[model samples]
Target: MGTERDKGAEQGTVHYSGTEGGWGSVRGIVETALRERPKPAALDALRRQNKPGGFMCVSCAWTKPKHPHTFEFCENGAKATLWELTSRRCTPEFFAEHTVTELKGWKDYDLEQTGRLTHPMRYDHATDKYVPCSWNEAFDAIGRELKAIDPKSAIFYSSGRASLETSYMYALFARLYGHNNLPDSSNMCHETTSVALKDVTGSPVGTCILSDFDLCDAIFFFGQNPGTNSPRLLHPLQEAVKRGCKIVTFNPIREKGLEVFKNPQSPKEMLTPAATPISCLYLQVKTGGDIAAITGMMKHVFAKEAERWAAEKIHVLDVDFIEQHTDGFDALKAHVDGTSWEQIEQESGLVRADIEAAADVYIEAKRSIAMYGMGLTQHVHGSDNIKQLVNLFLLKGNIGRDGAGISPVRGHSNVQGQRTVGISEKPELVPLDRLAEQYGFEPPRDEGRTTVHVCEGIQSGEVKAFIGLGGNFLRAIPEQERMEAAWTTLRLTVQIATKLNRSHLINGQVAYLLPCLGRSEEDMQVTGAQAVTMEDSLSCIHGSIGRATPASPDLKSEPAIVAGLAKATLPPNPKVRWDDWVADYGLVRDAIEETYPEQFHDFNKRVFTPGGFYRGNSARERVWKTKSGKADFTLPKKLNSWGTEDKDGRWRLMTLRSNDQFNTTIYGYSDRLRGIEGTRDVLLMNPDDIAAAGLKQGQIVGLASDADDGMDRQVGGLTVTPFLLPRGCIGGYYPEMNPLVPLSWHDEESKTPAGKSVPVRIVV
Candidate 1:
């Protein structure tokens, strides 16, 4: 059994191995597989993961290689697979044994560990438990409730796990039902990237492909840990390092993944302790300090260019690209010039010399890739952070090239694809006219609610229904306690999922838990076995066909479930053939192709070929699709000044995930890389901060948000563990630290919860 801990007490010790992914990773995979019942099936599914004609790993959105290895899957991918293909079943009998009230007290990990949901179940008010219900009964009841409520009051939330087809169908169904409240997982994480990238580059997606890693002279990582999050990516990074490419990292904590990696696939490496060094230089930037850090780098570049020009008339800036392909260079240069070194040093928590050193690396490199994750987003100035990175890249002309570009390392498998296929809250983002013309219904033009808006809507009783297309929605969002209570106010809640989660237990007046096929499970439709396609972080669309048997014969495919809900709810539209699309899925692809002719012209045929087809990015061709028709060098009004000071003894806290966890899914309690074992409630603090707070290591403490929002937000029993973090900057696992972030505490432009930087005071 996994080590158990008290809810609010420290149950683990601090031990940093300074390495990631070697024998430890292999052990983790083996242990995970051993724990999962029906081991043969789990092991078989693992081998097929990420292979051509195999299911996509339902973990991160990292792209796969064209010529794959025997074990293309990572440790987390294996855990995710075993997690989905587990023999443990949450049958009707299991639900009958546990009441909603009782299940509410269980840990989120325990809830999921109950395993794959086998049957459709509805909340029984009298028993406070979910009772088995026929598919027809559940659908009819949901349809009636949906019909009763105003379409605007209903929120359709799509998790990143949903395929392009399922998401496309989901968005279509929601719009056909008369509303555009299609908030998704992206709203909370990369909405800032979407909002910022679109303004800078015509496209919101990353321009670099998987192969770009090989050609780049340098790769800069900001706020993302590839080892735990996207381990498969480490392989390329490993190869890149071997080929003498520089890896630079800027993050609060020195992530083990970015430090060193041992390829588990390599027999020699597995037998030996030799590991590839990932980051050549690591900058421990303060929380919310990325903007200042980036600005400092840009300033250094400009300063160097001036010095070089004065000495030998040598040009450092990409003069041709900047003058012809980009706008706002002069304004950005002036902004950087006006910014003082003292301000940069103070805000970024780094010496000017160190910043210059990092900048020197960028200036010297022939080509570089600036890759960032939620760390750059999830801030009050999140959009500005992304904009500044783009500006930095633009100065050197890193984008629109073979070896360099801006790559936002996305988390979810198809989060980017969902946005591409119109799973957006912004009606302007989606091709509404085409959708209307194709679906034969006038699509809603009114702006829809984002995830934060949905939370507010639920609080105000404005949102009456929520239909989740796969995700632990309630558990993943901020203001968890408040949201949980607000969730009860909903008239209807429908979750189409493969397994039981905390969200399902947060019952409403009329709630239905609809079981859906996992990515590893076979989806047999009328046309035969169905294959769904997912778009990776690099915008490569590929096919995923489940090779394992269905966990439960009754489980429906996500597309089929969406079709059922659409058929039961909407008035029949002759143009939208829900039955036919769900039957073949090829019909759905054909519609997608028709909807996005330029991107998915031959989606079905091309997606199955080799490593899948690239959804060509216009920005990569230097054809700026922005209003200015040129890449814009945006200037932030000021550097991020939020959560910098140690005012009122409050520390800047950034919520992060453990190696054992993905999004809100807790695979296990061990974060082997961080040396965290058996607990997720520990707070990682600098030794100086620990001493300054008059708190000793292993001391239990509570955290209270310093947000101006009237509500008192606090979580307790977090054990203080000292680490090498910037003073006044601490880190804690996400979802646990989510409560300290108010719903309103989000990016001004993207409204992505500023989960990366929350000011909180330690409560002893």
Candidate 2:
């Protein structure tokens, strides 16, 4: 008998050499969408995605095209949206069947499959389950907890999925409530880019816009896989290839995206069978060795420029741009000259000839853009790694110009917007005087706990309450076991989310699951259906209107939830009207404009326009605003040896996401890109390394980290698989491998955990 197959079920491993984003991606999207949503529902969502006035995809922060196609969303974006709009419901009946204990035991994907949270849930100790509670009752209980604790003891966390309006209200409410402990997802991913880019370019945001890809002559991708992380970027790369623009890629693993790309959107390419080759030169750099590779390239450039100077009586660099717009070039030049090729090649795992070749590409191109991702930021020297790339670009006058600059690809949809809207622990970034004058309260102006610091505070009993605007803090932070345990000690833990996650399972003495409206759900207030704004990676602020009906009628918008909680929790102030702001989100934008007048002039009007407006980065216009009034050439002080083996013969282990997932959210059991199916509990290791370790394929092994920071870090029962990785390098799925990363193993300046470079040894 012929049987209808279970398409969701996994089969076996299948590997292929074809490029990403072809008919296969289309199939994956259609399969996943149909499985989750009905044909009409899925079609409706696709039609509205990334449209002029439609809801934004709550995935990556890739910029939308000015004139977008009807089907602007990619495979992963479609997967994310369908997952959000799933028909499965996590109602009170579902909770009645599963206790917190049993729910914790389920897989991350199974928990998600239980579906959208239907109402506000409160933990019941007697019932051992979450019971429905009224919004007022939940807020009142939360207010009691806030009133009982010292404001300094409460830690406020924000996720990148939040809109600019919600994040702004949350930040302001937290500060007014008397705490400045605002740590967000940015602290985990691109905090290094924000800190380091500011040091070099005098602005935190990158200098390049999306349009720069059209004008650039070359692009050097540093440790990024565009196929899965940001698939929309492949279109620009395809166009660049057609225009003869060189694309040089540096990554430890040879990702399929960097090798080639087949754009399904292109009619000409779709008619004929052809793949656009992405990388002209692909270099597999050693783990945490980007600084060495970049310095080696700079060394070659300096040496070649000397030869050019002698021959034509002119330097190879843009001498005028360098002399006028930069500072500290001589010191940086000396550092590069002093570095030896032997040491560079040994550390970088790249030959001098290849480094010189990449350098030649950079030197000859009139304009070039360097793009990097978490691969470059999740290191002990993460800030230094970013600064090195900045220094490389500055040498050739690449920044602050058309088609030439630095682009640090961010992870979340609005992580940059969250930062722009005052979600920071740094006192310097917070505008105290303006906030105090406009809002009738003194904003906290002291440096507070960051994500790493907040973890320490939680473990040390200094922080008692946690309010997460969005995100799974338990799975996202380092030392997962320790973090999960610490959350149990909190007096109050609140999660504003749409679905079930690990964070909601581990509760404090008093816990609340406040189900909030998703970006796709229409947010109706007293005024009517209100729209929110989100800022993309290129600093383009645009409105996202939710055309779909609310998944659950009981769910409240994030702004409403924040406002309701603030009204109940905050001290009585006749001047500040929380209810008024909740009635109309326009008041929130108007407040944001009043607070940051220089940046958000005519905010309501501009956001309603076609594509919104640019936030106006001074660095993008070549206007240096550093302390010295010029872009500075900074040098990394010491070479980082994060992933190098110690006396115990440990290998460098990096935590990465499976293609079936995003951050901590698991979509399915298979990683479709790598052809790994049925499971994610496998280690990717070099064949020679596996042989030397006396390990055969499919052998289950235990792994332990080298860090002795009073934490027992180990991951057990991981099946070994031979892969195309460099010698002494191993790979595992993130959050699964997170237990192997010690909390203390982090960047000094940025405080970002070195998830990309953990020293670990496999146990038999």
Candidate 3:
């Protein structure tokens, strides 16, 4: 195995390691945006992106500062904007030219490139094509099918892209329709974050805000690559580095963004080419080793506290805070003391010395923030991974203080907000008492199916109808082929989207694609141009107004579509005025306030304020709402690195999105950050592993899982690329490798698939 140069790779697709975010990021922003949009149109969208009175970027959930500079959007943000605002249109005539069967043959990127949907379409089985239909006709058919099926047999699925207002309406519609089968994109991504955070800290959302970056003396990262996922975060990390903050990172792969970053917006940096070095200490943890690594850090911190206590008669642990704000410290301390350095080194792939060094930085810092992404949450023991992080932070009294807290770096623009406004399968999260009091209908109190369960329900013929409120549901979930077949089992499948995607192509017996307005497009109703609100990763709920022309006159807002469906399906009720809610979104906000008055008090008025308002966290106030009325340090009982020992040299595969991709949406073939271009069909692996397997670089290989799920579960024709990864670990692009993931493998509590850790062997 050798490097890209040694392998004599293709001209443009060569892979290499380099510093992240400089002129290259700027170039990528321009080139990607210009592909889908004209220069003027791209500039207009870019100018409006993340600006006050303008729409937020639909890319990542990274928050904007109270005061933002011009050109606040990043490269991926521009791509998402351009992808949505593209001038191309998928007219009814275009659908006439290509049948649903023909469109199914198109690649995901190619299908999105066909551009925005121009009209409501219903699949015509005779022609195997989707034809134009009126919004009423589409809604009426969906209502008829929904009425026919058992309400519990219908799944109301949401994508993270939907605004808080839209999500609230969708949730209400589902509850009012007499079903609680509400599953969203959060199920696949940060469901573990919600489950774990709430259990440990008594709150689900991130405790810290963007301002914490400035005040924190140390930032510890676990399994996150901000360079490609959330480039805007690099600026704050860069500033933190400049402030002499110790940024330590633990990830299986050595990401370039965590190594160093040069903000393109900084004129001084652009002029002098000075890039701030990020991640003062980077630890290469093994796949699925987050819990072990976190445990190691806590173990080291405990040992240090023991030494300090003996030497200076001073307590390193915050005994006062622990007594006041926490519980189960003694048990956690005992567990840490029992856990040996040998076990930590074996599971974490980090020696005791490195773990101690990291613990030293944390021990030295007065205040530190732990930041993580999907890497920590996409494991079988992901919930435990979070609990361990909380244990580490709470050990030093990190909760409820400035510059110190747990920050789960979210992906989609409003996933956290979606949950905030009540899009959950969990009945307790929904304000049912408030809903009954405000809307005059009793909601289903029983817990509902998540994404994984929804798939199982569909496959078992229990769920007959599925409605996706703005996401590529079929592609985002595991077992793509299985999901496609399961979708066919459904009686009705509805997709509320702006563009055609794989989900739309995979037809149920009766399928309808309802074209909706993109976030950046003007949403004109009887109240005139409307402004929507979304909550970012930092819990900042801000207003977003679209000024651009809608891609098509037929396009409706997501709220409008939800309202239309609700009105058509549910009987007229005095309290639930669907038409009034659609005519003006403020009415929706009023309803939201009524449902979640504690969080959304004065919601309509407060959302319009500059920089919006924060949905203040209980954990931030140190007011724990857990059963014990305090933060709890739960000990992880089961600890397995990779969730598999890999005795026979089985590689642990983790699925990741390319730099050019956002969620399930593919922008291009290039992952500029990793220096991989032209194709996404290559696997990044450790050179030693490749050599041991007798596989040369650039050689095609077939992947097969070790799971006995009785599924064939194989994806072939992947070129092996030698890269800097820990031993026994490998990486592949997601959706492509999703088939190799067994549906049975998921976090038991959260019900999230372990897409990041799969025990797989090379097929020779």
Most lDDT-accurate candidate:
1
| Cα misplacement distance, residue 213 of candidate 2 (Å) | 1.0
Instruction: Point out the worst 10-residue segment of candidate 2 by lDDT.
Output: 1-10
Return the TM-score for each candidate structure.
0.97, 0.96, 0.97
Query: If both were scored by TM-score, which would come out higher, candidate 1 or candidate 2?
Result: 1
| Model 3 lDDT, residue 569, Cα | 92
Local accuracy by lDDT, each model: 0.87, 0.85, 0.85
- Measure candidate 3: CA RMSD: 2.8
Candidate 1 whole-model C-alpha lDDT, 0 to 1: 0.87
- Ranking according to lDDT, highest score first: 1, 3, 2
User: Model 2: clashing residue pairs?
Assistant: none
Candidate 3 local Cα displacement, residue 146, angstroms = 0.8
lDDT by residue for model 2 over 87-205, one digit each (tens)?
A: 87889888888899889999888888888899999998788899999999999999999989999999989999899889888988888998889999999989988888887788998
Provide the lowest-lDDT 10-residue window in model 3.
Answer: 1-10
Q: Candidate 1, which segments miss by more than 4 Å at Cα?
A: 1-13, 641-646
